[model samples]
Target: MSQKELTIGSMTVFVSQPYKVPQVTELIGRNEELELITAAWLAGPGQLPLAPLLLGEPGVGKNRVVHEVARRTGKDLFIYQGHEDVTAEDLACAVRFSDKSDRKMDYVVSPLVTAMIKGGICFIDEIAKIRPRALALLVSVLDERRYIDSTLLGERIVAHEGFRFVAATNTADLEGNAMPEFLRSRMRPVIPVGYPPREEIDSIVRSLYPRLNEHTGKLLDLFWLEWERNGQSTPPTPRDAIYVFNLALSLADFESLGGLRAMSADGEPFRVDQPGSASSLKESHLKRAMRELLPVSRENRP
Candidate 1:
């Protein structure tokens, strides 16, 4: 995506496009978490909006929660993906050659900066992946300071009053990564995004794979039985449910098409989309897909 350029205090910078918000049609059974995040965005005497940190396991819907809350508040969403190699300048501003201009340098503002300038919600996904040095840039922005000093731009950018911040980190990184204490202290509420209940999981699977029809409920129940009822220590997350359902349905189609498979690197499998020739998901397909795609299923067990 091409970024639009603007002059911020004499120096021209390319404005970062806020990452497109994924449209979430429904956020099942997460009313309380949303309320807390909304409350964090509130203000009172001697209070600034708390920068909430969403703590969760991978694929447990932390990103979805923040995106839905920001959407409900009618705020534009800016997403910054943090990584191990991210530096302080990368978080604030960086320079790149413009495609339009002949060898002209373009100052590209980061998503964090874009949100501050635009008064949108900035969500730093997998923030724990960022090194301590890079995260130091966030201290002022996340606290009462409400500003970031860009060494490269030689200017201090204050966050707009409407700007809100949220960060999500997987459990392993939050507890074990090299993120600094000061940065961690500023992001508050410590919201924990856990696995959804079985009913919600069933709903998500059904919604995501509606084509499965009668096979949906039975497949989800089998998943629950394999992970929950069988007393496995780690039950399948919502992601696993979606993945298994889609894979199983695909496998069922493959069976209908007489084991027709994708030969391309693009990963597009052969499809049988026609009438009575249409393949339906079955018990065997569900069982086989679970074993093949999910790590928790009986066949995948050591």
Candidate 2:
């Protein structure tokens, strides 16, 4: 964990490290959502950037959309995971044992505060899970005031010129626990992220696992067949499709290693035989993986 000490008014604090970008594959789709978020962050003379709220299903790639935008815009990204127990102060700063020998305690800034201080993009995932009271703290930061007051540090931290904020919540969450109207009004242009088209989902799988290109079409067919057989109305999310393929690949590898076995009668330990070459993904592998990972309905089963 990288750390940097900075002076905030009279007190000095340690800032949290920016989120490390993962080895992301090509972003498949959501061109419109990407543009909306980018446009919302654009600030003109005498205008503040709009804070956009992303609404989507759990596995439909809401977070990925923000990550792609942040990467394309070349900005530091800070992620804050929102949950039921997150407090108002947790959004700003917290105290920790000092890493340095000179001090007894270290004031640690949260991702939200760090983003404001460093002019980065802050993405709060599942923002609806946060209690309305705790979320009230964001009112000032999301509005023209563009600052957060930390009661712990006794400092009013103003956002840098480039600071941007975006948050996402599952569609179910919004229906169950309504967001405060005050905060909702501040978060403009609510973007809905839906399941991608079949072609895009196929592209995503192929891009992420290039080695499966040969079997991609057949595997995808089986995936959709299973979906339809189960009488599913909507298409599977990209995550669901990807997991099936991932599991299929794992099954193929396991087969090549001489699938799991029991110990011999003499009590010899089980052993896995190393494969001389990579195994080709087969229909059986996909079917077995899907059955285990995404079981078919009992009535629909053959």
Best by lDDT: 2
TM value for model 2? 0.92
User: What would you estimate as the lDDT of candidate 1?
Assistant: 0.82
The stretch of ten residues in a row with the least summed lDDT in candidate 2 is: 270-279
Question: Could you give candidate 1's per-residue lDDT for residues 1-302 as a string of tens digits?
Answer: 33477777878888888656677557787887899999999976687999888998988889889878987898988898988989989999999777765557778899999999999999999999998888888999988889999998999999988999999999898776456889888888889988888788888887777677776677677777765544455656788788877777777766666663443547665445643233477777777877776555464456
Q: Give the total clashing residue pairs for model 1.
A: 0
Candidate 2: segments with Cα more than 4 A from true spot: 1-3, 262-277, 295-302
- What C-alpha lDDT do the candidate models reach, one value each? 0.82, 0.88
lDDT of 2: 0.88
Best-performing candidate as measured by TM-score: 2
- Please give, for residues 71-153, the per-residue lDDT of candidate 2 as tens digits: 89999999999999999999999998976798889899999999999999999999999999999999999998999999999
Lowest summed lDDT across 10 adjacent residues in model 1 is found at 270-279
